[model samples]
Structures are given as C-alpha cells and as structure tokens.
Target: MDLIIRKYGGTSVGSIEKIKKIAQKTKDDINNNKKILIVVSAMGNSTDELLEKANQISKSPNQRELDLLMSSGEIISSTLLSMALQEIGVQSKSLTGFQAGIDTNTIYGQAEIQSINNDRIINEIKKGNTLVIAGFQGFNENLEITTLGRGGSDTTAVAIAASLKASVCEIYTDVKGIYTADPRIVKNAKKLDFLAYEDMLELANFGAKMHPRSIELGMYYKIPLIIKSSNDQEDGTLVCNSKDIKNLINKGIIMNNITENRNRVSGVTSEGNISKITLKNIPDKPGIAAKVFEPLSVSGINVDVIVQNISNKNKTDLTFTIDDKDFDKTIKTLEKESLKIKYESIMSGKDYGKISIIGSGIQNAPGYAAKFFDTLSKINVNIEMITTSDIRITCLIKNDDLDKALIKVHEVFELDK
Candidate 1:
C-alpha cells in the first residue's frame, strides 16, 4: 500500500463545515486504497488568539509555558478532525507531537526536530486507520513540550514525510500554487507549475509562504513536495531537484522548459518587516566584524544584508539588516558591547524593506542586475543596500516604496506573463 502524507493549513480546518469537508476528502482517499497520514495546523487564528491572551496576562510570558499553551491549538484541530472522520464512518486516530514520537532539541520556541520514531505511526497504519498528527509541537530531550516557530507545522509535515519515506508530501494552503510574485501584489503574476528546491528555498527565505526549513528537509531527503490549495482542485506547484524537473520537461509533461534562458527569472519577493542598524566610525581593525556580530548571534538575532565600507583613516561604518522584532534586542546587545567595540554612534532605521529576484544562474546572466536597477531607477526608487548570490539579487528600499518597486520589477522581468 502507498503511504501518503497531507498537511492542511489553519484556514483549511477553520470551522466545523470545513472539517467535515476534509473528512469527506479523507474518506475518498481511504477508499482509493492509500494509507493516509494527515497533519493539521491550529484552526483559523487560534494561535494568535492564544498569544493575545497570554500577553494580556503578562508582558513577557514564559517561553516554556507559552509553547505549552500555543501547542493546544493544533491538538484541538487534530482531535476534532479525527472525530469528524469517525463520525463519517471512517476509522481514524489522533496523536499529539509527543505521542507520535517527535524528538527535538531543548529549545522552547523554534525547536528543531532531531528525530522521529515512526513505530507508533506505522502501527496505526497497519491497523488500516487514518492517523491525524498534530503539527508544529514536539518533545525535547527532557520531554517538555516545545513549539516550532512560524511555519513550524510545514516543517513538521516535511520531517515526518522524510522519516516515513512517504511517497510525497502535500501542503495545502490558501493559494493555488507558488507564483512568480505574490499574486495580490502583482496583478499579472503567473503561477509556476514546478520549481527547483534551491529556488523554492530562496523564495521561502526571502518571504514566500512555504517554509525554508521544510524545503531544506525536502531537499535533503529527496522528497517530492507539492503545494496546492485545499478549497479548490487546481494543480499545485511541484518542488524537487533540478535534475528531476529536467526529466519531467524532457518527457513533455511540462510544456515550459523552466531550465531555459527565457524562464531564467523565477520570482520577485519583498519582505517589509526589516530594519537596518548602522555602527558609525568603528575602528576598522582585524576581527572587528566578528566582534560586532557575535553578540547579536548569541542573542538569537539574525543579521542579514551586511555591508562594511572601506576603511578611511583607520575607521569605517558597518550596517546590517535584521527582522523588526529583533531590532530592540539587537540594539541592547550592541550597547552592552559598546565599551568593548568602541563605536562612535549607533543608528537604526525601521522604515526599510528588501526586494529580491530569484532565479538559476542569474549572477552569470549579463545585464540582469543592470536591468533590475534600471527598472527601479525608472520609478524613482532609491536603493540603499545591495546583496547578491548566484541565484538571487536583493536590494534594500524604503518600506513606503515596496509595493511600487515590486510591481515595476515584476513587470520588468515579465514574470506576470
């Protein structure tokens, strides 16, 4: 029997009616002779509501307690879905993260999955029962409940699929598939039928809905992942290795040669929750860069898009971007090291956003950067910082101009077509 794993987002199981609909879908799958495992996220905005309730009680809720509280959302959804399935005459079982044997590190919030003991999952499958596992929450070495951060459920689904060696992992979301740009932001943005895992990873990291860790796990295990919408029967995007994609194109199943030059530009993405910090007049000495970033790293703050200017009079300026939520913590960390680092001044700006274009071999493509900058120039948008990789080019711009920049850039690359 073929084993299949399907993951539904919160919106998919937001209400009783939707849960019933999912029950019908699962019944159909069971009748098709496929052993099914379902991973469900918390229903609707319940997780957010939980956080709001916690904040109402305390300014800084304890991380361990917050994880335990937040994990209940998925548990509620999973159990409800299981009951819905049984009510519809299909045998099913609901299991929490710990019950399913998801082991992780000791981190309370943002814990990484260390391993999964699939014995229990296999036992349920052997009984011809549909297993509905709660997503995002896992147990640490100490057996304490820990929650994966944002998009953690996606990670959970992929990790389970990998461990079980399932045929494929399906991620059902609100959108039909991954697009060249956010469809709402670019009216003409086109849906990509397939994507290389590397491209998908870049897109997710820059701000796409799919999680980067999920993509990374999928890539590592060579698992095929499909992203589609639960509300509709439309085909979703397939993410896999480039070689696998090439085989599909050669088979004529995919009409467009995604590996070709015309399709070189994969997508344009923008992240608005970004802030830049600058340390001015720092002594440009050996190990200065290390000294400046080590504290932020220790504080669990991710610094991105760093640029250090050439030394002038043995001094230079260092600037970097971080997520808005970590800005205050980053500032605090830097201040504590001020005496040790001896910087002239520290300045931070929260009105910045990053726009990135992702594709394969983009760095080798002549005039791509020129065309990118030229398009922005035509719209009078100023670029603050520039960063690039073999497959992506990112630019920092004012948050106020993000929408305009995205639209113009999407058009320039003709991604809408």
Candidate 2:
C-alpha cells in the first residue's frame, strides 16, 4: 500500500464543516487502500491571534515560552480534525511534533528538524489508523519545545513526507494552486500545472505565496508535492525532481521587479533592512579591502552586493548589504572595530524591496540583461541594488513604487496579457 501524506493548512480545518469535508477526502483515500499520515496547521488565523495575545502580555516574550505557547494552536487543530475523522468511523490519532519523533536543533523560535524517527507513527498506521500530526513545532536534543519560523508548517509537512518515503505530499491551501502571478494582483494570471523545485524556489523567493524553504526540504528528499485548494477539488501545482521537468520550458509564469521610476532594470528585488556601511579614509591598497569587513565577517554577517571604488589619493568606498533582521546586532558588533578600520559612516534603511524576473528560458537567451534594462527604461523604474544568477536578475527598489513597478514590468516582459 502506498503511504499518502496530506498536509492541510489552517483554513482547511477552520470549522466543523470544513473538518467534515476533510474527513470525506480522507475516507476516499483510505478506501483506495492508501495508508495515510496527515499534517495540520493551526486553524483560521489562530497562530496570528496567539502572536497578538503574546504581544499584549509582554513587549518581548521569552523565545522558549513563546514556542511553548504558539505550538498549542496546531495541537488544537490536529486533535479537532482527528475527532472529526473518528466521528465518521475512521480510526484516527493526533500526535505532537515530539510524539511523532521530530528531533531538531536547540533554536527555540526557529528550530530546524535534525531527524524524524517514525517508529511510533509506523506502528499506529500498521494498526489501521490514520495519523494526524501537528506541524511547525518540534522537540530539541534535550526535549525542549521549539518552533519553526513563518510558514514552518509547510516545512513540517515536507519533512514528514520525506521521512516516511510517501508517494506524494499534498499541501492544501486557500488557492486553486500556484499561479503565474498572485491572482488577486493580476486577474489573468494562469496557474502552473507543474514546476521544478528550483523554479518554485525562485518564485517563492521572488514574492510568490508558496514557501521557498519548504520547497528546499522537498528537493533534498526528492519528495513530490501537490499544492491545491482546501475549499475545492481543483488540482494544484506539482513540485518534483528535475527528471519530472525534463521536457519543459516556458512554464507559464514571468515576474518583473522594478524599484524606482529611473528605469535602469526590470524585475529588480531589494531588501531595505540591509545597511550599507562604507569604511572611509583607509589606505588605498589591495589588502585594505579585507580590513573593513573582517569584523562583520567574524560576527557572521552574510554580506551581499559588495562594491569598492577608489575615492581619492589614499582611500576607497566599501559598500555591502546584510539582512535587516540582523542589522542592529551587526552594527553593534562593528562599533568595536570602527577605530581599527577608520570607517567614516554607516547608512541603513528598511524601506526597500527586492525585485526579480524569474523564468526557465532566461539562461538560454543572450543579451537578456540589455532587454530587461530596456523594458524598465521605457517604464522609468529606478534600480538600487543588483544581483544575478544564471536564471534570475534581481534589483532593489523603493517600497512605495513597488506595485506600479511590478505591474508595468510584468506587462513589459509579456508575463501577463
């Protein structure tokens, strides 16, 4: 019998009726002789509500306690859904992340799953019961409760599917499936029937709703996934191995990231939290480049888009970007080395956006960069920071102009009709 892992997001089990609907789906799968494992998220904004409640109680909730509190939402949903399954004559059980043997690192608010020992789950499934597992939260080496960050539930589902070697992991969400563009933003945007894990990563990284990190986990284990709607029976996008995408090109989607109205490039993506610090008045020598960033490097700040230019007779401007989440701590750590590097000043902003145009055919075309910039030029969107890989070109732009810029570039690139 093939093991089928179905992961339902919050909206899928938000009410008794919705749970009943899911039970019907489960019964169909069971009748087909498919052993089942179900993963579930907190119901209908429960996690968000829990976060809001935590904020109301404390300005800075302890990370460990926060994980403990937030995990309950998923527990609630899993148990309720399990109850619904039994009400319909299906044998079912709900297990917490720990009970299901999800072992992770010690990180309280952002733990990564280290391993999954599925002994207990296997025993239960062998006894003719469908197992419903809670998502997002996990247990550490010392058995401490931990939580995975935003969209971690998706990661949880993929991880379980991989561990059990399930035929496919089904992710039920609010939409029919992954679209070329957000349907709400672009009415004509079409859904992708299939997508490569790498392409899905680019789409998710470039602002698509699907979680990129979960896609990464799926790729690691060569697990196939179907992203479908919880409210209906519409087929969802399938994410699978490279072999599954062998004969495909032009995968029915294009994205354009434009920041400002200057028009240097199209589909530029930028994150504003990255502060660029230029250490000035340093000796204009080759090795001098290493002096400024040494402290940030030691502090483990991953810098992006580094640029150095000779400013005068004996000095140069050094600029780079780091994640905004770590911006404050990085700056605090750098203060100690200010005198060593003789840095002039530091500038930071959280009002930037990262824009990119993602497509499989991009790497095959020559002069693609020129064509991209030309399209942006016609639209007058300004470019801030630029980065690229063989398949993607990303730029940073102002947050205020992001919407108009994205739409114009998408149209310019013929991403939508």
Q: Per-residue lDDT for 269-354 in model 2, tens only? A: 22334445555456677666676677777665667666676568777666666677667867787677777667676656655666
lDDT of 1 by residue, 1-417 (tens): 556789999999899899999999989967867577999999999999999999999999999999999999999999999999999899999999999999999888888999999899989888877999999999998889999888889999999999998867889898998999988888998888888898999999998879899999999999878888999877678888767766545643334555422478899999997999999999999999889999888787878899988889999999999999998899999999998889999989997999999998686679899999999999999999999988999999999999999999999888876
Candidate 1 lDDT at 333 equals: 95
TM-score per candidate, chains pooled: 0.95, 0.84
The candidate scoring highest on TM-score is 1
Candidate 1 segments whose C-alpha is farther than 4 A from its true place: 245-262
Name the best candidate (by lDDT): 1
